[model samples]
Target: MDPIKKIAYNCRQATYLIEKQQISSITLKEKIELKIHLMGCSICKLFQQQSMLINKMASKHFADQHKHISLDTQFKEDLQQKINDRLHKN
Candidate 1:
């Protein structure tokens, strides 16, 4: 197989292993791999970090929604927009 295909396969396998919980999220291997990947591949590293964080937060149950944006900062703006019909005003 081509080197590109092999690299992609390896990345896919790594992601699968992580997603399938085959690797200890807190293990030394996980930490090292994450750091190394982050150094080499920013996009995949970011994705891995976010995916792992979500999985950990969900406790492997795969909840319907992963997170809620607290209405603390944007709430006021959203509330004002709603009241003023800002989104459709234009």
Candidate 2:
């Protein structure tokens, strides 16, 4: 495979790992490749910035709300069942 394409792919994987909080699982070489790609790819850089912003906002919102929220066992079970049904349907 072409080196540039490989680097782009690694950048994408790095972005996903970052989102999943799994960046520590990536190899040093992959981290370097992603940094190099982000340096030159404006679109990917924007994506990374937006993703980080979203995660920060979501974490803050959840932290504020979780203290006041309580879900019953039945509700949790029903929600999980619905999610599983939808996934299986798809």
Candidate 3:
């Protein structure tokens, strides 16, 4: 494939990997290609930054919300039992 097309493909794959938190899953050559593409593509770079920021903010928000919430063990066990009973009945 041509260099431009290859870079574009790499950028797309990089974004997918980033969103899935699987950057480490990509091969070394893919990482190198993605880095090179990011260097030349301002739009992709901005996208990467924005995606990371969104993920960070979401994680922090969820963490804070979870801290203030508690679940009763009995309630959980009862709910699971009820679900199992309904499934078996059907």
Best by lDDT: 3
Where does candidate 3 have its weakest 10-residue lDDT segment? 16-25
User: Root-mean-square deviation of each candidate, in angstroms?
Assistant: 13.1, 11.6, 6.9
Clashes of each: 0, 0, 0
lDDT by residue for model 2 over 1-90, one digit each (tens)?
898777765666757756654334676776677777777778778888898888789889888977977899999999999999999999
Best by TM-score: 3
Residues 15-84, model 1: lDDT tens digits: 6555655354456765555445445666676777899787687775555464653567588888987988
The better-scoring model by TM-score among 1 and 2 is: 2
Q: lDDT for model 1, please.
A: 0.62
- The whole-model C-alpha lDDT of candidate 2 against the native structure comes to 0.75
lDDT of each: 0.62, 0.75, 0.76
Among all windows of 10 consecutive residues in model 2, the one with the lowest summed lDDT is: 17-26
In model 1, the Cα lDDT at residue 40 comes to 62
Look at candidate 3 and give me any clashing residue pairs.
none
